[model samples]
Target: MTLTSTAPNVFEAGLPTFTYGLTATPHDILDDLRTAQSCAPIAIGPLGPEILSYSMARELLRDNRFRLPPGITLAAQGITSGPLFDKLTSSLLGLNGAPHIRLRKLVSKAFTPRATSRLQDTIREVMNGLIDHVVDAGRCDVVPDIARPYPTPIICALLGAPPEDWPLFVAWTEEIFKAFNFQPDVNFDESAIMRAWGELDDYVDGMVAERRHNLTDDLLSELIRAESDGDRLNLDELRMLAAGFLMAGTDTTRNQLAASVQVLCEHPDQWETLRDHPDLAMQAVEETMRHSPAASIVPRAATEDVEFGGYLFPEGTFILVNTFAANRDPAIYDDADRFDITREDAPAILTFGGGAHYCLGANLARRELAEALVVLTRRLSAPRLVGPAPWKSLLGMTGPTTLPIEFASERL
Candidate 1:
């Protein structure tokens, strides 16, 4: 990639910015930008320059010169050395090259398709249990009634933690994830976030002690035993690794599940298709993600000076690959904006990031989505949005903040 255009550098240029806030705007500025792209391929986003086109975004994500952001990105936002910062340094999110490969390889053992398939039963059990509470309610907020409560319990079960202890994990993950929202100007609470990570670490330490004495066939036990030949996870690695997994596993799935249902409820005929053919749950999840991904942007920083998509991004330049826009690029799909689960052989989605740093919990997240939709579509009928399904900023961990829907419960 070379800079052929004589236009000013993107960082300094007056590039078009999109609507990226909590307030509900009637029209998505991304759609306008998506349609009005005769000039440039990039947009000056809230977090540096954003790659908006599908092809360009894919190229950037798979490129090697682009690496995970440095600590200064967080440090810029007042997160200068805390439990959260330390966790980022040690966890897969902050690591690059050899350390990343090592930890990802060891942690991936518990996330393989076979492992996810084996855990699918637990997913169903948890989904069904949550449904038991809301199924008879007729009208309820999906975020609280279903989505929020669903993923953490499954994560606790995966870790062999007591199901009743899910609330603690949920609280910790929520606080810790706030650190990633990238609101450098906002009054970000550093102490609360750091304290949450410390609490989670303390909990993981207790679990490590208990599980070491009596290991079981759960993810914790698997992490305890996981190793790459001579290399093994030390207590510190295990504690941070498990805590990171719990955080990743919970917030992401919760947001995506809520987003999936909101999309389906908006398209009743699609919901009918999913209900009639429950097997379409897998495809439905794919369509929902592609249409409205809960995990939208994959943040990266330039490791070295590189010209990509005909623009020069100097070393340490922050970039956000806008999957939310890329997923709907007219160049990619025939009917890119339409939410059709029946679409045949849809291309792979970018919701899970890409290449070496692709989400480790992707398989489990998909299983959670598939099982959750299957249970919901089968047990509930005539699902329709009863109130505004308000959404948060797409800048990070995107999803509806609250989704209220009305439905009739089935006798199951």
Candidate 2:
């Protein structure tokens, strides 16, 4: 596809800077992204040296030549690299085109609906178990106790992580994701990253060894048994996949849950509506996905000149698709700034993404959020915000650092 304009594209403009309001709430970001998309899929960046912002998510999703920029590495300050580096940036979700498709197909077998159905029981149990501890506390830090670790245990059970080491997995994932916000010039050191990466690789390597010895009814064991032409994931692939699952399930779901709660707090009327109907949980989730998306952007590298709307994106441009921005386009959703959960068109949110690279864990995440809200609404007599929810300064996933909710219930 060729761009329509004769004007030089944004990619040729220079590096991206913080001009587009990176700190803006999800709604504002979406508005800007929509404007950019209508004008051109590519534009000058808002946070770095002159870079291209690819805002047409649907179009980019359809094309396969647009690769993830090498500079757009998902590496954490202290937890990525070495034998397990491939998990975040080189796994099924990381690759582009055919190789990515093949790997995803192999992994998709384990994520089938039937397989996920079996985890609902565990999901309910995990939610209740966490609530059991903090239900009567009046208030607690929701991010760490409930939102962050909630997805870990469920995924561990699905992946067959040993009970004793589940806590360790949680710690490793926290270190990896928290690195997204690390400003090395001020807060981090090389030794800290080295230590974190070493521990992560060592733990995953041990798990790989165990899965090899005793294949169980979990994803890790199943992968060990999976083969093609007598070839399977070697040690490096094994470690990376394990790390990938941990990071994906942990950060994405935690932030989604946290952001959902924040949005509900901001719109008590909408919260009451959902509390009354309960079934609106699904719609509420979609609204949260759109209004306060967990992930802020998706990066891509153009392999050929592509045109969309009315502009050109030349080959070798570093592209950033502001998913958060696309969800809030005024033309697409009426009163896009408001947090109304009951809107008839609220279900069209782009939270789980679009196209082939859509999140594989979307079903699992919805299940967790739905179940959590069900139990939470019924048990808590009155829930109110204790303080303003503070968002983390992360480049990718946007979530809260602390969320304290006051409630009368002893346990949810």
Best-fitting candidate, scored by TM-score: 1
The positional error of residue 35 in candidate 2, measured at the CA in angstroms, is 7.4
| Candidate 1, residue 360: lDDT | 82
Query: Over the stretch 125-160, how does candidate 1's per-residue lDDT look in tens digits?
Result: 888888788777788899998998888878888877
lDDT of the candidates, in the order given: 0.78, 0.66
Model 2 lDDT-worst window of ten: 47-56
Tens-digit lDDT track of model 2 for 1-412:
5556675565464322344444555444444455554554344655432222323565675567766643144343444655334434566566777776766666676566655777788888888888888876767777877887788888888777667877876766666654444233354444554466668778778878987777666777766666655656678766667766776777788888888877786677776777787898887888877778787667666788765434466776666566666676555677776787787844355666567778878878888887777666666556778886877543567778788888775422
Q: For every model shown, what is its TM-score relative to the native structure?
A: 0.90, 0.81
Candidate 1, position 44, lDDT: 80
Name the top lDDT candidate: 1
| Residue 147 C-alpha lDDT in model 1 | 92
